[model samples]
Target: MPQRIRKLIGTVLLLLLVVVWALSAMALAQGRVTELGWFLQLVCYVLLGALWIIPGGLLIRWMERPDQKV
Candidate 1:
């Protein structure tokens, strides 16, 4: 695939990923952490926030990978 096409697709995918991730996260946390202590809640939130980057990093690397010579 061409670089421009890959970038356009990557940008769209990233936006969709963010939207889905945020909504999924909120859904996962909603009313589920009410019983947890504040400190624990903070830790969970921090973990959740940072963990999404793993897959995103992989995707980005693939997206930016150089086109192979034919």
Candidate 2:
């Protein structure tokens, strides 16, 4: 894979993850925010955060491959 392509793919994946996380966080602000509810939402957020590592790691590894040349 080319370095430019790898960087583009990595950037797109990171952007996708950011969009997902932002949307998930924004879902909390519609109406009637609560303490316990927020806590649970935070737990869910953490879970999702952890789940992101797999793809994130893959993207990073792809971008970092020594064979890729820009």
- TM-score computed on alpha carbons, candidate 2: 0.54
Residues 2-67 of candidate 2: C-alpha lDDT, one tens digit per residue: 777888888998889878866765575443344457687677667655766777788788888776
On lDDT, the leading prediction is: 1
- Residue lDDT tens for model 1, 1-70: 8776787888888888888888888877786775799998998788778888987887788789888778
Question: Which is the leading candidate under TM-score?
Answer: 1
Give the count of colliding residue pairs in each prediction: 0, 0
Off by over 4 Å in 2: 25-42, 68-70
Off by over 4 Å in 1: none
lDDT on C-alpha atoms for all candidate structures: 0.82, 0.72
At residue 23, give the lDDT of candidate 1.
Answer: 84
